[model samples]
Target: MIDGAAKDVAQILGHIPALRRYARLLAGDAAAADDLVQDTLERACAKWSMWRPGTDLRAWLMTLMHNIFLNRVRDWRHDDGHAALEDAPEPAHEPMAHAPEMLDLHRALDRLTPALRSALLLVTVEEYTYAEAAEILQVPIGTIMSRLHRARETVRVLMEGPTDAQRTHPLHLVKR
Candidate 1:
């Protein structure tokens, strides 16, 4: 039993970097991402005994982290003004010029509904399989596909600078 537990701990430690990257994508604030990962580790440690053997540890940890983030969002829902009004320290000394393409992508992402954004982050950024992402997001597989469809369309139109209405229709998707 001790050997099993030790192995599990090692497995969880290995997933930390991937978890941090996903949290950063979700929150867009490095400090907030670290906080979320810290909370996730604390939860994992406390609940380690509850984890069964022979299951996917990475997926389990990700699901826990996702729930933590959702709770934070729920708590912030009632707040009115933009919270956390501090400047992110610029990339030391020399920051890359703000590329127009990058700016538009960020703006388009900002417009996504939270559900769609989470799905895209999991699938595109984290490179999770559809099944794993659905499990983490706690959504049906079809829902993941549909959200990705809609989010992509919205981003495409926004990036291309407002194409014809026909192109904007979600049903008429032109997959990239």
Candidate 2:
């Protein structure tokens, strides 16, 4: 029979692809994202005993990755030498197989703050509920909701500019 530890490792391994995607989005640099994923896996193995069996392993792993990403962001903010990924120039435009709308969405997403982006990704891309995302993000439910609202509005504004309802048009005097 496979040992419990081995089973845990297998489960964690199964989530690597997702972790990588989330990391890429959070880091915005391929090399940095890979490093983040590696760090997350290492932390998971070292902290395996803390994981409760019968719980959502994926959520737990996501939480670990999110925390690592946040720590890295904090360090980057404090460090003077290294530049944050958001400031890095956009990657050379390569032909992509995705739809144009998807590409536009990605560009808009890049503009959002890390907190908003993570909350949006968890709810929309990862299909996690507000409660699950809050647990993963270590924030209260209200915070997640607030982030989601802001993220959605930011993305909308970025992608489509202001809608007619939100646009303010200057009044023009007409000839009497």
Candidate 3:
């Protein structure tokens, strides 16, 4: 039993970096991301017995983090305007010397809705298959497809600006 428990802890530890990356992208702030990761670890440890031995541990961890993130967002929405200090807008800092396109892409990603962003990140960033992403997000495969389509289109529009056709006509009227 001791050996089994130690092995489980080792496996969970190995996924920490991935969890931190996912949390960082989802939360969009380092401090908040760290908090999310900590909460996820706590939850995972508490529920360790529930995890199936042969299942995908990384995906399971991601699903737990996703649920926690969504719950926090829901709670934040219900808050009475008493925002945390971390939620306060920070003073603008000089841009890093990174490539402009990368900066643009990051900004575009930030503009995405959490649902859309999660779908995009799970597939693109995490390299999960559509089915796997759907499972992680706890949605139907078709819903995952729809979210990916919308997320891609939105990011493209945000990064490249409106196309000439889009500028000339409403989005609905502009045929792809």
> Model 3: per-residue lDDT, tens digit, 86-164?
9989734536536888778878998998899999999999999999999999999999999999999999999888899
Instruction: Show the lowest summed lDDT stretch of 10 residues, model 3.
Output: 90-99
Candidate 1, position 39, lDDT: 96
Which candidate ranks first by TM-score, i.e. highest?
Answer: 3
Question: Which candidate comes out best when scored by lDDT?
Answer: 3
Candidate 3 clash total? 0
Q: How high is each candidate's TM-score?
A: 0.79, 0.84, 0.90
Least accurate stretch of 10 residues (summed lDDT) in model 2? 164-173
RMSD of each: 4.9, 5.8, 3.1
lDDT per residue, candidate 1, 1-176, as tens digits? 89977887789989999999988767766788899999999999999887767887888888888899889888788677645547535433323236778767766887887788888888898888888889988989999999989888788878886666764673755789
What ranking emerges by TM-score with the best candidate at the front? 3, 2, 1
Instruction: Sort the candidates on lDDT, descending order.
Output: 3, 2, 1
lDDT of 3 at 55: 95
Candidates 1 and 3, the one with greater TM-score: 3
Candidate 3 RMSD to the correct structure: 3.1
